[model samples]
Target: MSAFMTKTLKALGLAAVAATLAVSAPAMASGGAAHPHAPKEGFSFEGPFGTFDQGQLQRGYKVFREVCSNCHSATLLSFRNLGQKGGPFYDEKYKNPNDNPYVKQIASEFEVPDIDTDTGDAITRPASTSDHFPKKFANEYAARASNGGALPPDLSVITKARHGGARYIYSLLTGFKNPPKGLHVAEGQHYNPYMAGALATQWSGDPHHVPVGGVLAMAPPLKDDLVTYDDGTKATTHQMAADVAAFLEWAGDPHATLRKKTGVAVLIYLLLFAGLTYAAYRKVWHGKH
Candidate 1:
């Protein structure tokens, strides 16, 4: 079998096992108490509690670059945009030395087509086109082949698309504990309740879940300690999970901060306008009363 097919079958087998296990997990045998894992209510990704954590966002960028970028592509992002206040795309001087080589190599491999101003001939290099990012896999077929019959979905908008978005991501990263003693994830699948349709070998479809920076299925590409922060934040797994979640949240909504700012301004303006109108009415009514 081709390596890709072999991996796919393995993943499918695991998925079957996980599905059975998930189905059999004795549906909370009671109305007495809520299961800790029960779905949360009002889980919208808005409001103050779910607000983007800047510190976490910065760390998340470190995790993404250090661990998650191996098979996944942040083609939607740019090296230059890291300059935004809470963006993970920090400037060169602030980046860790170890991550530089691989990041640069990957960025350089993308072919960017450009017109030579003098000759006007189109040329391609390690960059993207208006319609496409550099191919992370040799082709789309190769990407699908590598995972179970599924292609690794582009992560650019994953945080935004998933049901829980931020919490779901954070939980998945820290969720890969040893499945209950009797429960072994079948050969091909991974053991995750959150990834409803995940392949066995495709834990969260990316390898950033291991105790280290990344996981074993794809190897821990971003091992702990790979990055040291000038801000003195200890690079723990939890911190990494939180930061990357924040960064991806930003990636999913680059204008989130701006939108919040605008919302506050609009609210303030309405309040001021209301106050002035009320005062004007009172002044006119004073003599009438």
Candidate 2:
């Protein structure tokens, strides 16, 4: 190889090594426990042609409402959003989600803090399509106090915010296991192979073989038959986890279907335009060659 190419390859190798160190620094500094990669899931919205399953999204919404909503707040969500095109509750008759009857009913189920207009006294009124999902606690401090000093994260964009998106959530929810023989789990802490934290101090195992997972305060939230689906689909723990993850994915990227469709249309248009351009060029210079 030429001297220039040899130098370039060496520089690349050094850069890659540096990057590896940088990424591993946190895990090394903590407990030498790297976060395990979540196994890939077969989502309905997986590929270029994949579209979301509306029924699954609806079931996911139910799971969130019945369970996750109690702790994690989806403050960015509004009832109207649930009825928008591609949403779980979308209806052909209701182009304006605000006017969607199903959305209106769901909104009414929650009471939101408000003030009496005449007296200015604090009161609460039934929520409307315009209101965002209410906070689970009055404030952040309250949220922490209620949950053993661990602040539940806002799940509005959780799928996008976390690595591996929906797959990570599914794995974490189902990945809880009994701590290994030498691992010491503290009060309020649960061992989850998918959660990230330092386990070196809690581990009494071989120094070189610290556990592959970390501890989390939140316990596994799903159980078999914990939720009764309106559509009568069996609510296994795995099913609920998958459903909720899919719902959160849709909530985070409600326009994904549209975006994918638009990309396909653009590709088709470009292909047709190329063929037409070739035909036009041939016709214009039929005998010139």
Which candidate gets the maximum lDDT versus the true structure? 2
lDDT per residue, candidate 1, 176-227, as tens digits?
A: 5444333335544444444444232433333443212112233223345667
The residue-by-residue lDDT of candidate 2 on 1-289, one tens digit each, is 3365456556655654564454223221123333433335567876565678899999999999999998898988888889999999999999999999999999999989999999999999999999998889999899999999999999989977766677777878888999999999989989987776778898888988888778888988999998999999999988899899889989888888897788667656655665575577668867885
Best by TM-score: 2
Cα lDDT, all candidates: 0.53, 0.81
TM-score of 2: 0.82
Model 1 local distance difference test score? 0.53
Model 2, residue 174: C-alpha shift (Å): 0.9
Error of 2 at 91 (Å): 1.3
